[model samples]
Target chain A: MSDQEKEVTIYDIANKLNISAATVSRGLKDHPAINKNTKKKILAAAAEMGYRSNSFASNLRKKSSHIIGVIVPRLNSSFMSDVIAGIEKVVNEANYNLFISQSLESMKKEVSNAKAMFNNRVDGLMVSLAYDTSDIAHFESFINRGIPLVFFDRIYEHEKCPSIYINNYKAAYDITSHLIEQGCKRIAHISGNQLRNVYAERTRGYQQALKDNHVPFDDTLLIINDLSARAGNEAANQLLNLPVRPDGVFVANDICAISCMQAMKKQDIKIPDDIAFAGFNNDPTSCVIEPNLTTIDYKGYEMGETAARIMINHLVNNDDLQKTQSLILRSELIIRESSLKKGSKT
Target chain B: MSDQEKEVTIYDIANKLNISAATVSRGLKDHPAINKNTKKKILAAAAEMGYRSNSFASNLRKKSSHIIGVIVPRLNSSFMSDVIAGIEKVVNEANYNLFISQSLESMKKEVSNAKAMFNNRVDGLMVSLAYDTSDIAHFESFINRGIPLVFFDRIYEHEKCPSIYINNYKAAYDITSHLIEQGCKRIAHISGNQLRNVYAERTRGYQQALKDNHVPFDDTLLIINDLSARAGNEAANQLLNLPVRPDGVFVANDICAISCMQAMKKQDIKIPDDIAFAGFNNDPTSCVIEPNLTTIDYKGYEMGETAARIMINHLVNNDDLQKTQSLILRSELIIRESSLKKGSKT
Candidate 1:
C-alpha cells in the first residue's frame, strides 16, 4: 500500500524528461540500447526531483527489498532451466533481483526454503512444488503478509494465489488416444508421485482414454515412482518380465521415458513394432534419442514468461492479481518415430 | 569494518544460552530438527540480549544485504545447471541469497549484467565470462568497493579476483592423444569461440597433441564456431565434404559433439571404425547418445561448490581469500565405446 502513496513512478520521470515511460525505465537501468546522454538526463531528473531518495527511504522504512524469491523442486532439469531463463529475462529487465533456491524434491527442504524466503522479505515468490509436498501450511506466511505468490508448472492449488501451467490432463489424454489409434492394445503408464496434481491428472487422463477406447483398466499396468532414470529402467525390466508385455508406454517425462526406451533397446526390443513409447515435456533428449521419442510439448519458457509477467504486474502496478484464475498454456502431442506403429504420419 | 565494531553474532547468543554456535544459529532459523523448547529459549535469550536489534543496526550501517550475484554466459546447459545447483546448496545453507543473470554469450550483455549486479550492491559476485568479454573494466566498481569477486569456468585473468576452473588444456590433450592411439591418423577439432580461454586453451592442446603424435598440424582440420547444434551439424557436413576426411573428431563440448556424431551417423558413418569422436564436459547426453560418447569430465558441481565456499568464507568471516588465489579442480578423460577403436581396453 505504501507503494501507492507518495512514490515515484517511471511515468513521472518520463513526463519531466518529455520522453516515453519505457525510455525512462530503460534509461534508469542504464540499458545498453539507450543512448548515454538520454540516460544521463533521466538520472539527473530523477535525482533532482528527489525520486531516488524518496523511493530508497520508503524501501528502507517498509523493508521492501525489491528481491523476488524462486523455489523449485530442482534446478538441474532442462525444463526448469528454460523456465528460469525466461524469469531472469523479465525480472532483470525491471531492475529487480531474483533469489533462487531448490528444494531438491524434498518437502522438508521446500518448507525450509519458503521460511528462508519469508525471512529475507522477498517482494514476491514463485514456486514449483516438490513431489511430496502435500501441505500448504508453509506458504501461509507469504499469503498472510500479502506478499505476492505465484506458482508455475508443478503447482499446488491455493485460492489466493495464481498458477501457470499447461493442460497436463488433456495432453496425456491426447497422447494415450494416439497410442491406441496406432494399434496398441495394452499400454503401460509410468508416473511420478500420485500426490502431486500434475502426475495425478495425467493418470486420470490415461485411465479415461483407456476406458473410452473400451480397454480394461488394469492396476498392474500402472507404475509409480519418483520418475527417476533407475525407476524407468526397473519399470522397463519389469514390463519385459511380464507374461503379456506392454505394447506401448506413456511416461511422465522425457528423461525417464528415454532411459526406459534405452533399457528396452538393450534387450533387443524393436521400437514401434514390439513396443512404442510416448513421453511428456518434449525434452531435448527426446529428439537426440534413437527412434525420436513421441512427446507432449510442454511450453516451459512460455509458462515462465507468463508467470513473471503476472507477478511483475502485481508487484509494480498493484494490479488485480486474480483477473485470470488460472493460465493454462496450450500443449499438444508431437508425433515422432518412436510411437509410429505403421509409418510416419508427418 | 562496521561489522567488527558492534555486531551481535550467533556466538554471542550461543554463549548466553549455554549452547553451541550451530544450535543458536539453527534455532534462530526455525530449523525443523531443533526442538520447539530449545528454539523458544534461544529466541528469548537473543531478545533479552538485544542481539536482533544490534545486528540489524550493524547491518544497516554496513549496508550488508546478504545477497550474492552470479553472472554466467548462459543457464540452459547441463553443466551450468549443475554448477548452479551446487552454488545454491552452499549459499542457502549459509542463509545468503543468490541473484543469477545470464549474458547469453554476449560481451555487451555481460557488461550490462555486471552493472546491474553492482547497482544492486550484491555482497559478493561470481562470474563465468562470455565469449568476447575481453576487458575487466566493468568489474572495477566491485574491486574498488572491496567486494569479493570470484570467477569460475570461463574466466579471464584478473589480478584482484580469484578464479576456479578445470585444466581444459590437459583434458583436451589427453582426449586427442587417446584418439591418436586409437589409430586415427587424421583428427579434426570442432571448437567454440576462440576468444574464450576455455576454447582457446583446448585449441592449443589439440595442436600440441597432433605435433606430439608426429602428425603435422593442418590449419584446415580446425573448425571454429559458436558450437550450437546447427553449427555442429553444419561442421560435420563440411568435414564429410573435405578433401581428406578426418578419421576422428574432438569437439570442445558434449552437446555439439553428440550433434556432430548424430549428423555423421545419418550419413552412414561407422563410429570408432570409420571416424572416432571425443567431446568435453561429460554431459548427460553423452551417456544417452549411442556408443556412449568418449569425453572429458568437467566437474561443474564441484567447481560451483568450491566457488561458493570461497565467496561465503570471504564474505562472512572476512577470511584471507588471497591464501588460495586460484583453485583449479581436477579433470580427466572418460573413455567410452564412441572412441574405442581397438575394442575394450579395460
Candidate 2:
C-alpha cells in the first residue's frame, strides 16, 4: 500500500465499526459524552484496523507543525533547565523539536506567549504554568482544537488536558514528617507563588502531616512569598519579628532556603542548632550550604525526558495516548545535617 | 530618491573614481589586497555618490520570520541561563522569538543544530560556541548572505562579527592581585578547557601576576582539569598527594570550588583557615557555601542585553557596527568571608 493509502482516516474506522465517520473520530479520542459501550466498540475497532492517522497532512491543512510547544515559568532556573535538558535529549533522538518560551512570571506575558505558540501551530503542548496565572483561557485555542496538552510542577485543573507530575503531596508529607521526627514543634514554611499547584500541594502536605502528628497547625508559621533570595531575606525579617520563634523551616526551593540561612546568620541565629532547616530540589546550593541542606531529590532531568518522550510517542506511535494522558514520577528525600537536630539520623 | 537609489553601489563609486567595480567593492569593505590610498579614494567617492550596495537587497530576500536562533553549550548552567534570559527579554520585547538549541558538548550535534537554524532561516544569529567547537565554518551559511551575527562569552579569534564580552585578561589580573594583596605566598589554579580564550586569558593572568609579584612560579602549582564538580573533587585528591601544600586556591568556576571545599572538608582541611579559596563566576553556590566564596562576578545578563542591542541597532537603525567589532563589558570581584583571612592587621 502507498504511504497515503496506509494513512488512517476517520472513515476507515467508521467503515470497520459500521458507524459514522464523526462518531469514530470522537469515540477513538474518548469524547466524554459518547456512550460507554459505543465508545469501547469504536476504540477496539480502530485499534484492530491498525489505523495510522495522517498527522502530517492534517497538520499541514490546519497549519499544525507536529511540534510540541512548551512555556516554562522561567528558563534559567536550575530545575527548569534540567527538565528541559532531559526533554531536549529525548525529543531530538526522536526527531522532534520543542518550541520553548518563557513567561517570566507575568500573566500578560504568559497569555502573549501562549498566543504566539498557538499561531505557530504546535500539534501538542506541555506547560509549567506561570506564578500569577489564574484563568487558563489562554490555552483554550489548543484544547478546542483537540490538541493534547499536559502540565508539570505547576499544573492547571483542565478536563481536556491531563497533567503529569511527581507525587508532590506525598513528597511534602515525607519532608514535613522527617522534620517532625527530628522533634520540631514550631516549624515555619517558606513557599513560592501560592497560585502555583506545586506550592499548593506542598502547603496541603505540611498541614496534613501536622494534623497526622497531632500538632496544631499555626497560620502564623506559614509565610507566603516568592521563592527567591530577596523574598527569603524578607521572610527572615518576619520570622525574627514574630512573638514566638519557630524551631524549624521548610522552604519551597534551595535558593530561598539558603537565603533564609544567610538572613538567620545575620541575626546571629545559628542553623541546625537555633533553627533546623529543610529545602526542596537537591540543588547545588544544598551541598554548598554549611550543615548541608536536607532536601527532596526531585529528578528534574527525568521529568523533562519523560514529558518529551510522552509527546513524541503520541505523535509517532500511539493514537490513544492523548486520551489516557497523566504520568507520575516518584520524588525521594535525602536527609542531611541541616535537618538533623537529634543525633544524626534519617 | 528610492531606497535603492540612496544605497551605495560599487558601480557608482567606480564611475566616479574611473576604476573597476571590483576595486570599489573591495575598497569599501577594506579588502587586504587593495592599496590604502585607492581604498580611501573609493570610500570618499562612494560617500559623495551615495552609491548603494547589495546589503539591502540581500536582507529583503532573506527574511526569516523574525526568529533569533540561540545555540548554547548547555541551558542548565548558571552563566548560560543568565545570558539567555537577558537575550530572551530583549528580543521578546522587540517582537522576535528565540529558538534555543543546546550542543550538549557534542561537535556533531552542534553542526546539525547550526544546519537546522540555517534551514529554518533565523533572521539573525546569536551564539556562544561549544567547548570543542573550533571550526565555525557552519556559520558561513549566514555570512554567505547578509545576516547580522553576534557572539557573546565564547568566540573565535578571526571573526568580523560584532562580539560582546568582557576583558578576561584584565579581570583575571585583578583577581590574582587580590590574592597577592591578601598575603598569599603560594596559590594553585584550577582551570577549564584550555583551548578557550576565557581560560587561556585567566591562565595568562595567573602567570603574569606571579612574575610581577617577584614570586617564583612553580609549574607544579598549575592544575588543568575540566571545571566541573566531579573534576574538582578528583583534583582535591591530586592536591592532597602533592609534595607541597598551597595556601591559596583559585578555581575556574563556583561549582568546582564548592566541590573542592566538600573534598577538603572530608580531608580535615578547614576553609579560609587551612586554605583560602576563590572562584570565578558569582554563582549562587558561592553564597550558599560557608565562609561564602570570594570570586569574580561575570555579568551574563548585561552581556546578553548588550549583545542583543548591538545586533538590533545594526539591523533596525542602519548602522555598520562591524567597524567596532569587539565590545568589552566590566567585571567585578566580590569578596566575602572566604578571602577575609588576612584582616585589618595588613
Candidate 3:
C-alpha cells in the first residue's frame, strides 16, 4: 500500500484477507448471508487494513462527520425559520449537526455556498433555491460525488435530486376562487419574479381561476415585483391610480399583502368593503393584521420534517433512493375577515 | 522529520535553516522588521518543508478549511436571523464558510453542538447560550485547544471569550422609566428565564427603575415565563384576573409583548388609555402592530458585523487578542404609540 493516507477502500481489506471485495463489503454491513466465521475474519482483516466506507460499514469503517448543510434564500422569514426549526429538531435528535447558510436571493451567493459546503465535506446537503437562481449546475459536483442532496420549499425538479414543496397551483386557485365567491368583480394579482416555479404556478392558477369564472383577464391587473413591503405599498399606489380599481387583491405572501392593505387603509379604503385581500403563507402577521388576511396555510414545519426524514432515510437505508424523487405536501385556503366581503362569516 | 504528518510546525522549518522558531513565525506573517533576504530564505524553506498556516497565509502554506461554527439558542426569531445575515455577509467577503446550529434552548443540545463543532475542526466558533445553559464547561475544550471563541447576543463573559451584546440593563431601565413618565404608576415586567444574563440584567433594571420612581415594587407584577407568545397570552390572563390591573407592561422582547397586547385588546381593554406597553428588540412586528410598539432598537445586524469583524481580525492579525475581551453595542428607546398615553409625539 502507498504511504499516502488516501482513503482506505474495501480492496485493501480484500487483498489482506485473501477474500473477494464483495465478501469484505458484505461483512462490513454484517449481512446475514455471510457466515459468522467468515464475517468475523473479514471484519478483523478490514480493521487491520484500515478499510473505510461512507455508508453501510462495520466499526472498522471511518464514521461520517455527521454534518448536514442547509442552504436557503434568507433566514429572516418566519416560514423559513419554522422549516429550519423542524429540520434542526429531527437532525439534532439523529445526532447530526446542521450548518445553515442563506443565498440572500442571489445566484452568486448560492453557487459560492454550494462550493463551500462541498469543500467542508458535509455528509449530505439540503437546498432551497434563491429567488434568482436559474442555473443548477453548481449542484452537479455533489451529484457526481454520490453525496445526497434534498431540496425543500423553493426547490428545483432535477432527476435523482429529491424536492419537497406544496401544491402552489391548487392553493392559488382556491384563494382566487374564494375571492370570486366573495363577489369581487375586478380582482388583481400581486406576484413575485416569474422565474421561480412557486410564483409561476400561482400565476397560472390565478389566470385559470379567472378564465373559469368568465372574468375578462386584463394583463394590467397582474403586477410582478420582488414582493417586498415597499413593493406592496407601490402596488397599492398603482391600483389606486388605475382607471378601474380592483375590488380584490391576491398577493403572493402575507407580509406584502399586509403592507398593501395598510397602504389602502391609509387612503380611507375599507377592508372587505372597498378592496378584499388574500395572500399565501399564513404568517403570524396575517393573524395580527387588522381585518386579518385571508391566506393559504402551508405547513412549513411539516414540509421541513418530511424533507429531513427522507434525506436521513436515504442516508441510512440507501435502498429506497428512488422513492424520494418528488413529494408535494397539502395546502388549504384559510378564509378570514379580509375576504369576507358580501357578508360576515357569522 | 517524523513519519506522521502531525503538522509541519515552524520549528521544523526553523531547524532546517538553523534559525529561531520565532523568526520563522514572524517571516511567515511578512513582518516588516525581518530582513527581506532572511524572510525570502525562510519562505522558500517553509514551502519546501510543507509548512502550513491559517487562511490568510500564501498558497504554499497549507491553507485552512476556513470554516466557522455558530451555535445559537434558536433560528426562528427575526433578530437572530438578522444577526446571522450580517455575519454571513462579512465572512463570505473574507472567504470563509459559516456552519450554524441551534441549541433549542437546551444545555444538552448546546453541549452536543459544541462537541460536534470541535470535531468538525472549525477555525473559529460563535455561540449564543441556550435558555437553560448555565455551565459552560463544554467550551473548555476549545479554550484548551487554543481555538478562538466569540459569544454574541445571549453571551457569557469568560476570561478570554469576548462577548458582543447590547446594554440590556440600561435598555430595560429606559423602557420602564418611559412607562412611568407616561403616568403609569404600576408597571409590570415580563421577562424570560433569569439564568440568562440578558434576562437577569433586564429584570434588575426593571426593579431599579421602579425603586427610583418611588413606586412600591410588587412581586406579583413580575411575570417570568419562557416569553413565548403563548406565555404572553397566559400572562395577560393572569394580569386580567388580578384585583387591580397593572396600568403598564414592559416585556423583555417584542413578540411576547405584542402577543400580550393583542390578548388585552381581545378583552376590550383600550391600549394606552387603560394600559401602556413597551418591549425590547424592535422586531418588525413592533411596527406593524396596531398602536406601533414602543421598543428598544437593538441593532442585531451591526452586532453581528462587529462580532465577525472581531473574530476575523483575531484570526488574521493574531494580535491584541485581549483587547476584544468584551464589547457593548449601543441601543436606544423607540417611543411608539403603544406606550404614549400623554399625547402623540406629533
Candidate 4:
C-alpha cells in the first residue's frame, strides 16, 4: 500500500467485519443494544485504524454540543456550592462539561446568561433560577431547540422543563409539625426571598404547621428580609421588642440562625429556654454556633449530582428524559441543642 | 454607493478615519488606545454596513465549541468559590460559557477533569492548580492551539499564562506582623496544602514575620495540613497540649480559624486573653464567631468581579495580552476581639 492515508469510516469497519455500518456506529457510541464484546472489538479496530468518529465529532455532525449550560443564583453560598460540587462530580464522570454562570441574584443578568448559553448552542441546560426571576420567556430558546432541560432548587412552574429538587413544602411541614409537638404555640419565622418557590413552600409549611395545631397564625410574627446575618440580627432585635414574644423561632438558614443566636446571647435570651430555635440547611456553621442549631438538612450536593446525572444519562445513555419529569430527593430534619426544649440528645 | 449593499472593511474605516487597519481593528475590539467616541462611530458605521467579524474566529478556527474550561481545586471552599465566581462572571459577559470542573483536592481528579475539559473541545481555558498538581503538560492543548489561558489562586509557577489574585505572601505577612505587634511572643501557625503556593506563602510569611521581629521561629510552631475546619480542630488540640504553649495563633483561612477558636473554647482557652488569634479571609463566619475573629478580609465577591473583569478585558479588548501579565488586588487587616490582646478594639 502507498504511504498516502485513507481515513477509516464506520462503513470500512462494518464491511471489514461483515456487519452493518449502523451497528458499527452504535457500537462505537457504546450503545447497550450492541453487545459489550462486539463494542470492545469495534473500538479496538477503530483505534487501530485511527477512526475519527468520536462523541464531539459526532455531536458536531448532528449540530449539537454535548454540553449543558447551567446558570446559578450565586456561587458563594454553602448550599449552592454543594449543589455545584454534586453537578461537577456527575457531569465530569459522564464526559460532559458544566458551563456554570452565576446571576449574582439579578434577573437581568440571569436573562443575559441564558441568552449567552443559548447562543453557544448547548445540547441541554440545568439552572437554579435567580432571585426575582419572574419571566420564563428567556428560556424559550432552549425550549424551541427541543433540548433536554432540568431545573433544581430556585425552580419555576415551567411546564416544558423537568425539575429535580427536594419536597421543600413537606420538609418544612415536618419541621414545623415537630416544633408544634414540642409545645410551641407562638412561633416566629424568618424567611428569605419569598419570591422563590423554596422559601414560599417553607412559608406555607410554617403556616400549615401553626394551623394544624389550632394555634392562631399571626402575620405579625413573620419577619421577611434578605435573610442575611445582618437581617437576622435585625430580626432578633424586632423579636426582642415584641409586646407578645414568640416561644419558638425558625430561621431559614444557618447563617441567619447563628446571627440570631449571637444577638440573643447578647440580650440574655437563652436558647431552648426562652425560645426554642430551628434553622434550615444543616451547614457546618450550625455546629460552631453555641447550643448548636437544629435544622432541616437540604442536600445541595446530592441535588447537583442528581441533576447532572439525569441530564447526561438521558443525553448519552438513555433517551427517556423528555418523558421523565420531576424528581424529589428526600430531606431530613436534624435535631440538635437549640431545639431540644423537651430534653436533648446525650 | 449602491443601496443594495455598502461594503466596508477594517481598512475602509482606517482610511475614512485616517488611521491604520490595525488601529481600526483594535478600536473595534474596544482597545484602550481607541477613544470611546471613535469606537462608537466606527461601530455605528460597521453595524450600518452589516459588519460581522469575531475576534475568536480568527484564531486557528478548530471547529471546537466556544467553551472556556475552568479547573478549580474544590467548589465548597469560600476562597475557591470566589475565584470561580470571578472567572464565570467574565466568561458569561463575553458570550463565552465556562465548563467548570473541580479537582476535589486530589491530583487524580484534577488530571481527569483536565482530560474531560480538553476532550470537550474547550476553546480557551482557565485553572487554579489543585493541592498536588505537579504537571503542566496536561494543559498543552490550549497552549499549542494559541488559545488565551489564565490562572488564578493556587497557580502554577513560571508559566506564561495571565494570572489574577491578591498577594498571598503580603497578606499573610501583614496578618502575622499584626499579631507580633500585639505582644504575641510565641505564635502558633496553621498552614494548608504546602504543595500549593497559597499555604507555602503563608508559612514563609509567618516565619519571616517571626525573624523580622527578633523572635526565634520554631519548627514546632508550624502546623501544616488541608486548611479545613477539621484540620484546625486538630491543630488546636496540638497547640493546647504544648509544653510551652504559644501566646497567639494565625490560621490560614477563616473557616479553619473559627473551628480552632471553637475547639479552644471547648477547652476553656479564653480567646485574646490566653491566646490572641488571627485568621485569613473575612468570611461571614468570622463575624458570627464569638468575640468576632480578627481576619484578613479577602473579598470573594470583589475577587470574582475583578477576575472576570481582567479576563473579559483581555478577551474583548486587546490581543496584546502578553503585555498584561498579572493582577493583584489589595486586602486589609480587620482587627477584632480574637486578636485584641493589648487594649485593642473588639
Candidate 5:
C-alpha cells in the first residue's frame, strides 16, 4: 500500500502531540478523565494527521456497527423524502450513520436490500414495504437474531416487528365523508394495490363511507391501479366515459389526484362543480394545483422521526420493542376548494 | 452468544448438505468449477440454514468495503430525491451498498458526515456541497488516499476530484435571455446563498444576460437569501413595495418561485401579464402551479446515475478518474404559460 493509503491511529496522533496513546484515545472519545485543553489539542493533532477512528475494528469488538439501514418503496415522492429527512435528522443526532436504499416498489428489490442489510449487520433496520411485498420472510433473520426491525408507512402486520404509521382507515373515511357532505351522491375512487395495508384500508374506508351515507356501493366507480400520475390520467378518462359520470373522486395519493384533476380540467370539467376531488397525502402539489386539493394531511417527517426514535431507543436503552408494537401517528382532513361544492359549509 | 445469535457459516451449510466445505463455498459463490445442480442445492441449504456471507472478513482480506458514500445538502427536495433514486438504482445494480447522509445545508454537519464516511472506510465518495461549504479541506483525505471523490450539482473546483454537473451559468443565462425576449426590461432575480457555486454562477449568468440585452443591472432588483418558500414570499413583498417593480422574475429554484408567484397572485398581480416568471429545476410543483412555471429542465436522475457510474467504474475497473474532470449534463429551457407575455412567440 502507498504511504497515503496507510491508516492513521491513536499512536500517530499521540506522537505528534507528545502525549500517551491512552490519553489520545480518551481525548478522542471525549472521556471525562481527559482535560479540556488536552482534548482540544489532541483533536487538532488527530485532524492534522488524518487519523480517522476505525469503525470497522470497533464494530468487530463491540458487535455493533453504529449504523442503521433504511429501506423505502421509493425515494422520489414528496412524502417519502420528508420521511427520509426526518429519519436522517434523528439517526445523525444519535451518532449513528445511515445506510439507505430504495426498493423501487418491487418485492424482489426489497428482498435483496433486506439481505444486504442483514449481511452488513446493521444495528437496526427500518422498512416501508414495497408495493407487492406479500411475504416478509426476508426479514425473519433480523427478528430471530434480535436485531431491531421497524416498519413505517406501508407496513405489514407482524407480531414481532414494531410498526409506525398513521390511521389510514380513519383518514380515508374522514376525507370520503367530507366529499359526501358536499352533496356528492356518486363518488369514484382511485387506489393502489389491495395487498398493501394503506391502500386496502383506504379502499375499505371509501366503501364504508358510502354504506354509512345510505348510498349503494357501485363496483364500477372503483379504479385500481399503481396510483401513478399516468394511472390517474387513465382513471379520469375511465370515469369521464362512464355511463353515469361520478360526481366526486377520491384518490389514494395526491400525485395521482392532481394529474386526474388536470386531465378532467382539460376536458372542460369544472372542479368542485362538475366533480369534487379529494386525495390522500397533502403533498406540496396539492396546494399548488388549481382549486387546491382536499386531502389527508399526514406528517411524513414526524412518522420518520418516530420510527427512528423507536429503533434507537431499543438499541441504546434496551427498551422493549413489543411495548410499542403498533404506533399510530396523527393525521387530519384538509378541506380545500376542490371539495367545496355549492352550499357546502366551510 | 445464544444458539439463535450464533452466525451460520459455510461449514454448517456443508455439513447439512453432506458436501466438502470447499465445495460448499465454491457453490455458494457460484464458482464455475461447481456443477449447476450442486450450486442450486448449496444455495438452498445456505438460505435454509440462514448462512450469510461474511462481507467483513472478505473486506478485510481484499481491503475493499464494496460501499460508497453520498452526502447532499438535503433529501426533501424533488431534485435531490430523484438524484438519490437514480444513484440507488445504479449502486444496487453494481452490487455495492450505499451510505447516504444529508448536510442540512450546514457546513458543520457536512464535516461530521465526511468524518463518519471516512471512519466507515467507504471505497469512494460523492458529494453535493452544502450552502455554506466555503472550503474544500474536509475532502483532502479522500484525494490524498487516492479514493475517488466526485461532486455533482453543487460542486467545487479541485484538480484531484472530478465533478458532474449541468451548465448552471449557461442555463441561467438562456432563461434570463428568454425573459428579456418576452419584453421584460427590468427583471428581478431570486437566488440562494452566494457561497454555493450553483447560486453564485446563476447570479453571474443573470447579470451577464442583462448586460448583453442592454437591460441595466439593478442591484436593488436582486434578492439573496436561503431561497426558501417563506423567503420567496418575503421577496415578493419587497419587490411589490419597490417604486418601480420588475416586469419579470427569475428564481434559482422552483419551490421558491412557486411560492413567490402565489404571494404576488394573492395581491392581485396577474402572471405573465403583470410579471413574467421563470425558475430553475423543473420541480413537479412548477407545472402544477397556476399558469405552469417556465423553468430549466435538468434530469437529476441522469446526473445521479452518471456520478455513481463514474465512481463504480473507477473502483471496479480501475478506470482513470482524471480522464473525466468535469462532466456537464444536458439542460433545456422549458417555456410555459407563466413566462409567455402577450405577443411573445412560443
Candidate 6:
C-alpha cells in the first residue's frame, strides 16, 4: 500500500543513537543490566524514530496474546451493550485488550468469527452463542489447544467450557406463575428458536408453570419465532386473530414484548385487563412503554463481569476451568403495571 | 502456564503426514502449486494436530494485522450499539477483524484505549471522541505513522483523519424551527459536553433557530449535562423550579428526553398542551414513550458503514485518506405527537 511506511525497529534506534543493537534491545525492555542513562537515551531515540514495540512477535513466542476475544449474537440490544460495557471495564482494568465481534444471530458468522479469533491467537475467548448454533464444533479448536473459553448468557453446556448465565427456566416459571396468579387461565407465550438453550429452557418453564397451575397446555398458544420486534408484532396479530385470545402473554424479551403490546393496543386491546404481559431482559424500554412492562430483571453487566472474571481467573490466577462448570446469576421478577390484572392483590 | 500446550506448527503437521514442512505450509495456504489431494491431507492433519496458523507472527513481518480497531464513547447507548453492529458487518465482510473498546466518555480511558490499539498494531483505527477529550495528542502517533485513522459520529477535525457524521447542526436547527413554528416562544435546550463537536454544533443550531424566529435567547433556559437519563430528570426538575417554565424542550438525546418528559408528566404536566418535546437520536424508547417523541432520525448503522468503508478503502484499496476528509450523512426531522401543538395544522 502507498501509505505503508517501513517499520522502525530497535536496530534503527541503535543506529540513530550510535549504540549496539543488543544494548538498544536491553534498554527498550528495561533490562536491569542496562545503564539508566543509556536506557533513557535509548527510549528517547526509539520515540524519535517512531519505533512501536513488536508485541505480536513477542506474544507469539510467549504463547499469550493478552487479548480477549468476545463474540455476541448482536450488539444493538440494551442488555448486550450493558454486558459488553461490564466486560470492557473488567478487561481494561486487567490490562487486556478486547476483540469484539457479532454473530448477527447466524451460526455461519459465528463460525467465521471463531476461526478469526483462533487465528489471531487470543488468550481466551468469550461467547454468547448465536440463535441457530446447534453444534459448537467451531470452538473445539480452543478446547483441544487448552485455550481458555467462557460462554455467557446464551450458553452451551460443555465439560471443558465454563458458562455464566441466569436461570432462564426458573425466571420464566416465576413470571408465568405470576401471570397465573393474576387470574389468567389461558396465557400466550412468545419465544425464539428452541435450538438455543435460553429459549428452550424458557419454553419448558412456561409449560411446567401451566401444568403446575392446572392450566391446560395449548400448543396453539405458543408462538415460536426469532423474537424480534417484527416477529412480536406478527405474533400479536396471530394471537389476536385466534378464536379465543389469551388472557395473558409472556415474551422472551422486552423489545418483542413491547412491540407486541403496542400492536395489541393498536387493536384497542387494554393491557392487564385484556391481557397481562411479562417479558424477559428488563431492557430500558420496559419502563418507557405505557403501563410499563413487567419483565425479568437480570443484570447483563453482572453476567458480563462474571464471565470475564472466570476467564481472567483461568488465564491469570491459573484457576481450574473444570472446577466451575456453570455459574447461574440472580434474576428477579420485576412486577409492573403491564402484568398487574385489575382487582388482583398488589 | 501449566495449561499451555506446545503450539502445533507446520512441522508437526508435516511430521504426522510424513511430508516436508515447506509442502505442508504451501498445502495449508492452498497454494496452486500443491496438489489438491495433498492440500486436503495437510488440512486434515493440521486440524487433527490442533495447529493454528500464527497470523500475528505473519502480520508482524507483513506490517499488516488485517485488524481494524474501533473506539467509541460508550457502547450502552442504542445508537452506539447500532453503529458497532454496522461496523462489525462491513469489517467482517472485508475479511478483517475488529478490536473494539469503549471510552465511557472519559478522555483518560480514550487515551489508554488508543494506546492499546496502537500497541496491538491495527491496520486502521475508527474513533468517536469521548465527552471530555480536550486534545487529540493521543492520536498523534497514528498520524505520525502512516496508519489510516477514521472518525465517526462525535468527531474531531484533523487534516489527516477522515470523519463520517450527520449534519447535527441542521438536524437540530430543523427540529428547533419546527417547535418554534408550533408557537413555542420560549423553548429550552438540553445539551452535552461542549468539548464534543456534536453537542456544540447542536447547541449552536438551537441558538440560531431561536434567533431566526425572533425569539430572544435565554441563557437560563439552556441546560448542559451528560445527557443521561438521570441528568435529564434533574434538568426537568430544574426547569420546573424555574420562575417561568419553557413552552418547549429539546434534548440532545432520546434517553434523556424521554426521562425528562416522564419526570414532567409525573408532576401533572400535560405533554404538547403544556410543553412540547423534541429529542435527538430517535432511540427506540422515543416511540415507546407516551405521545411519541419528535426527534432527529439519523442512521447510526449507515454512519458506521460509511466510516468502516472509509477505513477499508484506505487500508485495502490503497486509496488516499485525505481525499475523503469529511463525509456528512443525511438526517431527517421526525415530527410526532410530542411536538405537535393542539389546534396546529396536521
Which candidate number would show the highest lDDT if scored against the true structure? 5
Q: Please report the TM-score between candidate 2 and the true structure.
A: 0.80
| Per-prediction CA RMSD (Å) | 8.8, 18.2, 11.0, 10.0, 2.0, 1.8
DockQ for every model comes to 0.28, 0.14, 0.19, 0.24, 0.75, 0.76
Best of the candidates, DockQ: 6
Clashing pairs in 4: B86-B304
Superposition TM-score, candidate 6 onto the true structure: 0.97
Instruction: Give lDDT tens digits, candidate 3, residues B1-346.
Output: 2343234578988899999999989998999988999999998886555454533223113324377888988877889878887887888788777777889899998998887776556678999999999888888767655678899988888887899998899999888998988899989899999989999999999999989999889989999999999999999999988989999999999889999999999999888889999989998888888989999999888988999998888877775657877899999999999898956444
Better of 3 and 6 by DockQ: 6
Instruction: Report how closely model 6 matches the true complex, as a DockQ value.
Output: 0.76
Q: After superposition, how far is residue A248 of candidate 4 from its true place, in Å?
A: 2.1
**lDDT tens per residue, model 4, A187-246:** 899998888988999999989888878988888899888888889899999998999999
lDDT of 3: 0.84
Chain A TM-score, prediction 3: 0.82
Q: Candidate 5 residues A74-148, lDDT tens each?
A: 999999999999999999888898889999999999999999998888889999999999899999888888888
* Root-mean-square deviation of Cα positions for candidate 2 versus the true structure, in angstroms: 18.2
Instruction: Give, for candidate 5 chain B, the lowest lDDT window spanning 10 residues.
Output: B54-63
Q: Point out where model 6 deviates above 4 Å.
A: A1-4, A15-44, B1-4
Q: Residues B1-346, candidate 4: write the lDDT tens digits.
A: 2332232468777777777788779878899988899888887765544443542233214454556777888898867787677667766767766788888878888777776765565656777888877777767545544556677777775455777667888888888999888889999999887878878888888888888889898878888888787898899999988899999999988888888999999899898989998998887678767768999887766766665665566656755556657777788889998898856544
Off by over 4 Å in 3: A1-65, A342-346, B1-65, B342-346
lDDT of 6 by residue, B197-220 (tens): 899999999999999889999999
Residue A170 lDDT in candidate 2? 87
Candidate 4 Cα errors over 4 Å, as ranges: A1-58, A157-160, A193-195, A264-268, A322-324, A342-346, B1-65, B119-121, B342-346
- Runs in model 2 deviating more than 4 A are A1-66, A343-346, B1-62, B343-346
